[model samples]
Target: MLIITPQELQTDRLVNQLAKTWQEHGLDLETMLKTLREVRSEYTP
Candidate 1:
């Protein structure tokens, strides 16, 4: 049994839009996540 909230649905839609834009720019989800991790690590103490 699985359930999804409205907020989760909205987030999925937003991610889909972002993914499309990233693809148009020659980027990908994996690269986005890796960049996010690297940026966060830089800010962490």
Candidate 2:
């Protein structure tokens, strides 16, 4: 069995809400991967 505190529950809810918002805005996997590659190219030695 596992226990979750109120704060943890709230954090999880917030994360889920943010994820839903991102999906609604079309922040899909391909967009995220492209952004990550661009950022890495800028900062990598």
Candidate 3:
């Protein structure tokens, strides 16, 4: 999985560890952190 962690991204412990792995994995972790901050702002300067 795409687990690019750090930068203070604890996101409720990664949404309770991805809600215990899976099962109707309806995601919405803050809208996937605003689409991973707009795809990391095109790779930070």
Candidate 4:
């Protein structure tokens, strides 16, 4: 069984809005993820 809470719903909406805003700024989730991985690698040793 699975259930979704009101807080989760709100967070989902917020994430959607953020993703839209990021797209408008010329960055999508994939690009952000790839950048994060690259940055982490640089610091990892």
What's the CA RMSD of model 3 in angstroms?
13.3
lDDT of 1 at 32: 88
In model 4, the Cα lDDT at residue 15 comes to 97
Backbone clash count for every predicted candidate, in the order shown: 0, 0, 0, 0
Pairing residues by index, what is the TM-score of model 4? 0.67
All candidates' lDDT scores? Answer: 0.91, 0.85, 0.74, 0.92
TM-score of each: 0.65, 0.49, 0.22, 0.67
CA shift at 27, candidate 2, in angstroms?
1.5
> Per-residue CA lDDT of candidate 2, range 1-45, in tens?
999675557889887987888799989767888999999999999
Q: Which scores greater on TM-score, model 2 or model 3?
A: 2
Candidates, ranked, TM-score:
4, 1, 2, 3
- Predict model 2's lDDT versus the native: 0.85
Regions of model 3 farther than 4 Å from truth: 1-23, 29-31
- Candidate 1 per-residue lDDT over residues 1-45, each given as its tens digit: 899665557889998999899999999988989999999999999
Angstrom error of the Cα, residue 7, model 3: value is 44
- Which structure among the candidates has the greatest lDDT? 4
lDDT tens string, model 3, 1-45?
788765756898886778766434665667678889999999999
